[model samples]
Target chain A: MSFADVNIQFLEAAKYTLGLFFLTLLIAIPLGVVICACAMSRFRPVKWLANTFIWIIRGTPLMLQVIVVMYGPGLIFDVPMKNRFLAALIAFAINYAAYFAEIYRGGIMAMPKGQYEAGKVLGMSKASVNGLVIFPQVVKKITPAMGNEVITLVKDTSIANIIALPEIILTAKNIVATYAIIWPLFYTGVFYLLMSGVLTLFFKWLEKRTNYYKA
Target chain B: MAFYQVNNVYKNFGDVKVLKGINLELDEGQVLAIIGSSGSGKTTLLRCLNFLEIPDKADIYLKGENIFSIDNTDSAAASNADESNISEVENGKNIQTDSEKNQPTHAKKAKPEKISKEMRKLIDSKRGHFGMVFQSFNLFPHFNVLKNVTLAAKLKYDAHAPKGFARWSKEAKAARKQAMQEINEKAVALLERVGLGEKLNSYPCELSGGQQQRVAIARALILQPDILCFDEPTSALDPELTREVLKVIRDLKKDGHTMIVVTHEMQFAKKVADKVIFMADGIVEEEGTPQQVFEHPVSEKTKAFLAESEKSIDEE
Candidate 1:
């Protein structure tokens, strides 16, 4: 009921929001590269499977995916689903990885064929060409697009609320219902604004550093 | 046998025949200039030499060794050629015992012996013997001038380093450091030779087009390729920049470095070439000395191409 109490409660809830954001990024970014590789694999079946999975994930809503992930196993397999946070994390990671994978694929495909030819002429193996020559350029290219996805992800962490995970937005909603006061819900916007602003500056700095070597 | 030989090389892209049984030869320290118009397949031939494009049918020899051969007429024969090449090396009956073969055989035998292993080694060393420069320069944009020149050489050294020691062992680390120092020194000398000593720290984007191409030349030279192949090295540059690149190539010629240049620069070709080849419609229309080709071309196609090239030069 007190402002200090409300602040403490929001701060506790902020931990979950921040946890989901960082953990999802940690899992998704590298997973995206793996998925991108699968989608670009020379083998037709692998490419098709990866592409189909990406299509399904991107086409469906994150909120719906969260609910399905949290409850699907219990209904489909008749098993008890106890870990709500784990289910939400899985849904968020898989969904974001698909978007990130497409961003990576786009960046890689945009590279000039001459780059590969140049590497071949230098007697570099295909692995060396991808790791040394192509990947760095791809990273530079995908930075802005990746930044946009990351910003979207910050807000998307709120979708975990559908699974009743105690992230900041869900906690704020609980406070609103319990106290019949609306200000706590509005106060959650301040946390999101501050988090996204830091991320914007961080991405700007990253883009500048990578620009030291122009693609 | 010639130091480098392209025997009846043929390549087709889809239904379009790009190279029609082209035959050519070059001795050591000779520059063979290939002159042709667009779609003449000169670039494709150069690509084939670099192994960037696999010819549908071909035999490529470097330094009297059959480095590449494909008998697309029969897939079985093509594979047999590869198998024979590998068996020759494995049996130690190979004529040329290069540094690659000097490695301990028992150490090599430790891995599950696949035919690809021997074939890859042969192709890798053979490919290393020729350095290629592209029309666009194709310098690694993410690396600086020095790094661009040194990267491939460093990768090669690391790859061919002795096999037994753990990668993080003291001896391995020390060997790596020493090798890196030597490669860096050679790279510096090469960049200086190409008139780019001052731009070692500069990235590809920071340099002029000519400077970038010169960096490319330095990068190529660092490998100590037996023959350097230039695929229209100056085509992307303006007249002034072209002169600078031509000067570097001329200097390389004076140093007795063997080269294959694909170019439309008639005057440069005439001045720097030991042998001149006029290609039209994916076949050699004329092959002779520069004087013979330029002054007295045998084929009508060669004569018309020369005249057209001269007119373009005059207009420029």
Candidate 2:
């Protein structure tokens, strides 16, 4: 393949990688927040359910989770999986949300109880206390941990190739197979590196932005 | 005829009796200071008044309105001691005739409704009526000093504003702007009053212990509460800082604000308090005017505690 052809092809595949990454984050972060809230819920049954879900997701490997999520319905229920993109998206979102929920729980748990008490004594409603005082501090605390997970997510997108979902690495492998060119396969590393580098920069900016809250 | 009364208050924390049948009456513009050794239930009593620590049974009455009774407006219905209500006082001291004395405590009436759950919530929303300053200050560390002082006031205003007024009406928006201007101006003045005007932009962590406590005091005062409760507000401060905080509190006393202060500062207590309550274990051991309590304490427990406290001061 010509250099320009390689660029155009890689860019087209980059779209899928970025789409999976963004969609997973868009779905997972809010899902993670809800899960974290449930995990810390006052209701014992809800808390237990959330904890059990987190334990199951965390104990198993993400690769295995992705495989099972993509194929488990087809294998167990005898229902053929319809959409490859939807399968990949569901697998990634579920796996990442579990990890993100734990990070959120840690952030929420680390805050001083005095913050809530102070908010209450000032006549703030329970919801207002969480939104105005507690969540901002939690967000500041979880940023570094979240940044690490996000960087890992960039690389984990490559695992989608196991199910023939053509993201960046799969496209590279296709090029190597068709044209018998070894260079494009190595060029794929550059794409992952650049994506992670940009994400690292973005996360660094986020951490700085939240520097106003000191513990 | 008292402005406020904590009648037959009791609290237990998992079998440990923290407050046992505590009773006291407070007058308007009176500053009552509570003093005791550690674990003496002074803080618990303050918390009970604010409903921060829900007492097992407390009949808190403000201007003869049973604040913990369900229907405070009906004097006939106020016989159900445990029911609660929110009484918003607006410049009138329409002293209801004291009917509580005539109602026999043992008179068998239909069982009072178990309204503690609903009353707990009702009392909680009325907590703004009692501003509290903790020993540790407990200022929101995430907020700057100005935000810390203004936060509760703004939220309270927002909460009490007619529902959806801010979102739907131009008139409401104009009113809100005017209200916000007044809040900010009042907040600035409060910060200034606490000697923290120059530190308005400083974060809680950036301020010293005394400065943070002053900010906390300002935060509490912004609500313009009916009563200000201090849980050893200067306990965490050094002597210099303690003096600064005490000076501010003294100024508040001069301003005729009703206050309930729990303090180890006996001199400050004696100087500022209209009534001094000396508590030991879980009950009031002795209480009187500051002169009688400090100079002629009736109980051995009060006398001993005062002597020990004075010895500690001498050692310092």
The best candidate by lDDT is 1
TM-score of chain B of 2: 0.83
State the DockQ, from 0 to 1, for candidate 2: 0.34
**CA-lDDT, candidates in order:** 0.86, 0.83
Query: Using TM-score as the measure, which candidate wins?
Result: 1
Structural similarity of chain A in candidate 2, as TM-score: 0.95
Instruction: Give stretches of model 1 more than 4 Å off.
Output: B74-121, B164-171, B312-316
Candidate 2's residue-wise lDDT over A3-86, tens digit each? 788878999989889999999999999999889889877577998999999999889887787788789999999986887777
Query: In angstroms, what RMSD does candidate 1 have relative to the true structure?
Result: 6.9
Model 2 lDDT tens row, B1-316:
6898888777665556778888998999999999999989998888778766555566777877766632222342454345433343211112322221112122114222233434546777678679999988889988999999888888877877878634558887888889889988999999999898899898998989999999999999999899999999998989999999999999998898999999999999999999999999989999999999999988999888888876854575
TM-score of each: 0.90, 0.86
**Model 2 Cα displacement at A114 (Å)?**
1.9
> Candidate 1: TM-score?
0.90
Backbone clash tally for model 2? 6
B1-316 in candidate 1: lDDT tens per residue? 9999989888766556789989999999999999989989999899878866556677788889877766443453556566765333333222232222112232233322122445456656678888999999989999999999999999998788877657778988998999999999999999999998899999999999999999999999988899999999999999999999999999999999999999989999999999999999999999999999999998999888888777754585
